[model samples]
Target chain A: MKLSREEVVHIAALARMSMSEAEIEKAREQLANILENFAVLKEVDTTNVSPTTQSIKLQSVMRNDIPGESLPAEKILANAPDREGDLFKLRPVLE
Target chain B: MTDKYTDLTIHSAHELLKAKKISSVELTKHYLDRIKKVEPQVRAIVTVTEDSALQQAKQADEAIANGKATPLTGIPVLIKDVMCTKDIKTTCSSKMLENFVPPYNATAVEKLNNAGAVMVGKANMDEFAMGSSTENSAFFTTHNPWDLSRVPGGSSGGSAAGVAASEAIYALGSDTGGSIRQPAGFCNVTGLKPTYGRVSRYGLVAFASSLDQIGPLTKDALDSALVMNVISGYDSRDSTSAPEAVPDYTKGLTKNLKGMKIGIPKEYFVEGMQAEVETAIKDAIRKLEELGAKVEWGVSLPHTRHALAVYYIIAPSEASANLARYDGSKYGFSYKDTDSMWEGMEKTKQLGFGPEVKRRIMLGTYALSSGYYDAYYLKAQKVRTLIRREFDQAFEKYDALVTPTSPTVPFKIGEKADNPLQMYLSDICTLPINIAGIPAISIPAGFAKDLPIGMQIIGKPFAEKTIFKISYAYQQVTDWHKKTAKL
Candidate 1:
């Protein structure tokens, strides 16, 4: 349950977040405390219990694989922070 | 006459609009005026759609005059900013989406619009519906109408406070854990969290997908029922939306509970619960007993103690995944200071999210990380099954269960802002219902030191009607729901 600074940084990287040293220290302490509270779950005996991903039981819904009308390029790009022509503009992925 | 329009519930407003006693435009204007007057003190609204509301209200009047009106026609409604509103900003009280307006409406918003309901404005909430108190809002915290210094329990605090202050007749909010119910309890309004899959989630912004549900916050239980009728139904757009038929929820509003069995779980009365909250809930139970319903005590939900721990794990894990959509390149706030896209993505998230959101995302990432996944995420899911089974057993012996909606009345802002665990504990009474995917409602039972107390009625899956029946009956006898904030 004790989260080290290294672990916090690794988790942040995985989550695609850049945290300052103060935030990392704060997260290290807070996440450790939260996980410590979750330690009680270890006491429950779930030898054969199945994991519940969804609360309500339902079969995956299927739909026709046909092409359908989609949002116009203009509408889809309306909220994009950076756009070029009809495509989302981003800093080069590889340099 | 203006006061009369401001005081009208959705049900009453519908009648007045139909009888030609009030026009939709007039009713919408009265609420807009109320919002203008009270919003400075309450801070419940994020964006007031004055122009669009009046235009919609004029359209509703035309529909009513043309004799083609629905039950919700001409009724002004406040929407939780988490739901998509076409051409209107849906911020979720986060800087990430501060100026992000959707091009299409959420299924719930579409349904309400089809019912002729006017969108008054978007109510404020915690960023991404992450916190128990509105303090987590990136913009500002919502004040409880009853006590301006106290927080309206959130992340649906704005929706609850709006209804209590007559800023809106009824508001829609999404509940993940106790977002809707706790705030409704704090603000002395009736809030319902319909069974998961009973309502469509197509347009709702996902926080913890499995646990989230959109419901109503209203002046009373009957208003909740009326709103439910308009909003609940299966939609092909939401894969998780149940295929089962949505009944006429209003038909369950009768003030009768003969032969009903209500269970009181012993685990809910924890050590730190406010003495006043305990007393109000017990008094409400006695009232139910006097109304010919049987009350059973000592019902054991042994897994209840572990629900909080389970929720913190599962909810954050889902949130981390759901929130991954907010990277800089697409929509929302982007960080352009960095030349590399990867650095920009990271910087955007760092700048966009607040403390609580980052904390949750970190916790979720750590739990779902390679080696830790089995120990944290898998273990929590297995315990979740146990929690659901405990409710299943309790429901077998009782028609519904009753508990104090919150362990205490609304607390002052900043009292528990620094302490995350304590804030999470505020939702102790309501989280189990969400984990079980059952329907539950928080109705005003009484007041504690001038602040409202809510008693929760929980029912089996898709049993909103049963909870409505019990809640409506309780409202018929008590004046709690009739009291309004002096603001």
Candidate 2:
């Protein structure tokens, strides 16, 4: 279950993480070992079994649509690393 | 350590306050002074909120004078840094959100606040709640109070260690896996993980959405119960918060193990576990029988062996999705060196997250990727169903189950840091309870060579009282819970 270096690179890309060659190699070996453990799950017969997404019963939580007090804009924006007036400032995605 | 206020439990401290022997400010000063002295050795706290804690202690004293005191009134406590504390730094012991201060309080914190519980500071945790040991913490490793060279099990290591070291009466910690219970085991304290949806997850930072729940790390079973009474209730803020009535957790906890059907799951006593841990847990189970519990052996949970694999899939898959919010956009750390926003997001994550966090994200992304989804993620989820069904079926026949909280005593700090799979296996005994969404308590059973051993009592869903009662019964008969680790 050795993941190719290319597979590791592809995953890092998908996760928006950049890893050096050494890091990718290490991740490849480790992830493969963890996944190897999952080989046991493949043997279980789950033909009609439904996947459990939530551990408890599901329900729709309702709330009134009426406007209520909320955190002020300044407070909501307090933790932003970079901000402009009332909006977040970000690096350019397209120039 | 010889001071009167240093090792006070919440119940005893409350009585002293009620009798006017000590004001909340005096008690707090003693604890604050204690923290100043011991924190250099234990390193369990991340941010010490001295000014605000004393302010809250002052208010607590005023409330006590008016005879409007609750059980937690004037009690000093610690909140795990994973929970949001308005205006206080809520770092998950990671650089990613090292300075992230939320504008709100976690529902559990709010409950403690209403009860006049004084929050002294934020406790440390594994970065993003990712590691089994506190070595993964970015700031510093929290030393086991019993043996400073060994790790206090994590990611709730700091909270458990704080209580064991007599730094605080108790602390609030979040458990997605074995985070709460394992650390409590390592530190010789009582830790409870309530049934899923029992406590609100509104302001706690999400790791694995389905698995995360907040609970108390305290001195003994009774203190854990008292804290549970305050924090366990419905909240409209979290959609998953249960509407179930929270019973008076401190009441009806008699040594009535008579005819209380208990199952000792055979799968839990896996091969290669520390022999000392096995002997201690078995001795605790026998003591339960002596007190009249109808203990049964060889109960099978065949799916138990696969629990760790199922958890790794479900947890990290959910984590990869939950953590997508940190993209150098709305809050926390941002990378400014890159002009390309996409590259900036990548660099931000790379620089901000620790190794374990990135490893989990990669494991999750690889599992959910197009070709592997059905084979890994979907299959794991289905097996999760099988595991839950086993627990539910077993509970139908037994009132509760008993197992070792952790497979071994606390290991040396650097023992398993580099090996991810080995670290993950440390939680094998405790993960299935989270997977099945049941309640479990880890109470100090005995010690192995001076390090503490913990016995886990697990109950059916929303049956926290039953588990707490059993743990309380055990505490009544044994002095293990009464012993404190020497700092």
Candidate 3:
């Protein structure tokens, strides 16, 4: 697959990262090389091999719903860069 | 105090505490003093819990006084900033979460605290564990303890450097691909990436959920075992956690392996490996041979060449899905000057994530997105199965596989920062195990040109005990693991 500068920008936007022109160029080249390297996977002939998701074969170990104590609010906000009354305060999201 | 305490392993420190030769508070103070003296140069810590550490040490001393203490009692430990610690700034080395603190402890932190392990502080790491070097940390990059000019290795670089410099008796590091082993190699400490399900992932911040495993970065193999025993077990909170019984990992420490077979895959000795690394690994093999283990040149992992490629696809895909949670509304770090919700999220994410992290999230989103899933993500899973099958076939005849952890020793900071491919290739020898979901460890094999070299011992699935035994045996026979950098 050919990766373009615009695609790189699109991906960056999707990933929620702002990039400079230089980073866009660098990401394009790096992703290209990685894509080319990963092209080797296309060569391996897997006619009937089942795709494995989890390495272990176990399944369905769900637990019953249970209540747990929440940590104290003071402890939660101890490291906050900015905190308000019982909540983590931040810059206004909308102008 | 200078020489002995600086390189003391968790095992030795625990022995001294048990024998009443040293007090837990004295040991904690010794490490705290060391961190105070050396952390300025290393930059390994983010938030230090000095008061809490001393209080914890006092409690440990009281426990021992009351005749009840575990093997890890009184040992000081450093956690990667990614793990949540109550009231402690668990930054994950990112500015977005720079002021973020958890209200409760991660299960691992709680377990370690209950075991009487003193929490030194949170160690610096790659922001969200996104990069190979701690250079990507939003706070600061960790310098190698051996050579201050170079990177220690990351996103677990802080933990690696901490243990290497004895800033902490032992440190816990999370490995996605080669985070644990790569830094351990560079810092010349022992690092273990336990089997995927063997260690609980409850408290560890998400990087690549399928690949991340929390393990120990320590001075020697025995301490790795001790830490592993305490950390590994079934956690009801983590669905992927293994339900298997946690064995007394230190039980096989003195077991002899006169005829055990060790495999040496020729693919690992590929062209890009540096001469010094090759020499150190060869020397380690010879030493292992002399110790009565039968060494054989084995060739089974033909798909090993595709490991790095497969890892890039698989890890990014998982990371893309895992990182979707940090959208500025529900979690830490949000930029909110924009008009729309989408714009707000974009502003927050763009401002929060670093370049390396952004690049990965993009790649992962692209791989897992529409029309490309079958070609990239699904194909990668199929290839993953083949990789596991290859290891299974190889381990049938051989007890374990041996190789160098990293191609070269610690590289200078910003050395490969521009060249991402060169940085990615560092995981060439270590990525296969994570793909196959097996346990592998990096121990100090020897040194080349003043820097340390790491020897990787790859074991079968759920057979971490075997790797521990081999590494412990190697440490007994060689003094390489005992060498300390005069920082």
Every model: iRMSD: 0.9, 1.0, 3.0
DockQ of each: 0.85, 0.82, 0.47
Candidate 1 stretches greater than 4 Å from native:
none
Best by DockQ: 1
TM-score per prediction, in order, is 0.98, 0.99, 0.95
Name the top lDDT candidate.
1
Worst lDDT 10-window in candidate 1 chain B: B1-10
- What is the per-residue lDDT of model 2 for residues B101-137, given as tens digits with 9 covering 90 to 100? 8999999999999999999989999998888788889
**Tens digit of per-residue lDDT, candidate 3, span B158-266:** 9999988889988999998889999999998999999998888887888888788899999998989889888889999888898889898989676366878999998
Stronger candidate by TM-score (2 vs 3): 2
TM-score (0 to 1) of chain B, per candidate?
0.99, 0.99, 0.98
Residue A3 in candidate 3, Cα distance off native in Å: 2.9
Residue by residue across A2-95, what tens digits does model 3's lDDT show? 4799988887776766677887787787788777877888988777877878787668888988988866767655554457777776556565
